[model samples]
Target: MLEQVSLFVHSMWELLVSKHSEGLYNSVCLAVLLVLPLLLLLLSVCLCCQGCCGRTCCCSSCRRQQHNRARRKKHDDLWISSQPQPIMMESLTLSV
Candidate 1:
């Protein structure tokens, strides 16, 4: 029984081989082989971007907030230093 099944499978393989060079079968096989590697590469790139980019993105946002806070502090200090003295202003007005 198994021998008969084997013979049938051999005949089927031979028929497929004879017809495979005709056109469409060869093209379909070629397309699948070519696209498989490209699909795998794209999947790896997506996973790497998700891992490496996510961590760096968080750190960058944190650093930006710290930088903005420091800039605001510097501006506030300069603004306070430039203001007029209250007693000097009153004495000047009385003198005038």
Candidate 2:
């Protein structure tokens, strides 16, 4: 049984080596080695974008823009309210 298993492994290795010498096998291996990582990177980027966008994939930029606009509006409102009002001359004269 051990001898049979060893022979099977040897035969499989020889077959693989022989196939590697063929251009088709090498091309397939090269494609997998090169394209697989690019495919995975693209997939990861797409998934990350989807997650960042929350419920919608197409509105990530739009949502970010809206958030920025809302934040700016809030800041502007706060700044306007925090400014000191100018004193009228009549009121100042009356107070004195």
Candidate 3:
């Protein structure tokens, strides 16, 4: 099995490198050239989506901002709770 695998690999390498395989080599190169940019574009789009679509990315700034937002909310809640409430007043008509 190992010998068969090695023979296959050796034959493939020779085929790829031989002068008779120009068409095969051109096809392989064309495929790589065409696919590489698309793969890179996909990777960039996925990364951008992860960063922009309310998802956690591989950065500390978003985490820091999240913590800051939570802290601000907590502080605002405490401040609001501490404020005086308005008293309910009925009609105060003076009797003549």
* Per-model root-mean-square deviation over C-alphas: 13.5, 13.9, 11.9
Sorted by lDDT (best first), the order is: 2, 1, 3
Model 1 CA lDDT for position 45 = 99
Off by over 4 Å in 3: 1-22, 56-96
Model 3, residue 33: C-alpha shift (Å): 0.2
Every model's TM-score:
0.37, 0.34, 0.35
- Can you give the lDDT of residue 2 in candidate 1? 100
Clashing pairs in 3: none
Candidate 1 residue lDDT tens string, 1-96: 999999999997786676676789775886687699999999999999999886665577788988899999977775545667666665555534
Selected candidate, larger lDDT, 1 vs 3: 1
Between candidates 1 and 3, name the one with more favorable TM-score: 1
lDDT for each candidate structure? 0.80, 0.80, 0.78
lDDT of 1 at 74: 78
- In candidate 1, stretches whose alpha carbon ends up further than 4 angstroms from where it belongs are 1-21, 59-96
Model 2, position 65, has a per-residue lDDT of 86
Q: Give the least accurate 10-residue stretch of model 2, judged by summed lDDT.
A: 74-83
Question: After aligning candidate 3 to the native by TM-score, how far in Å is the CA of 41 from where it should be?
Answer: 0.5
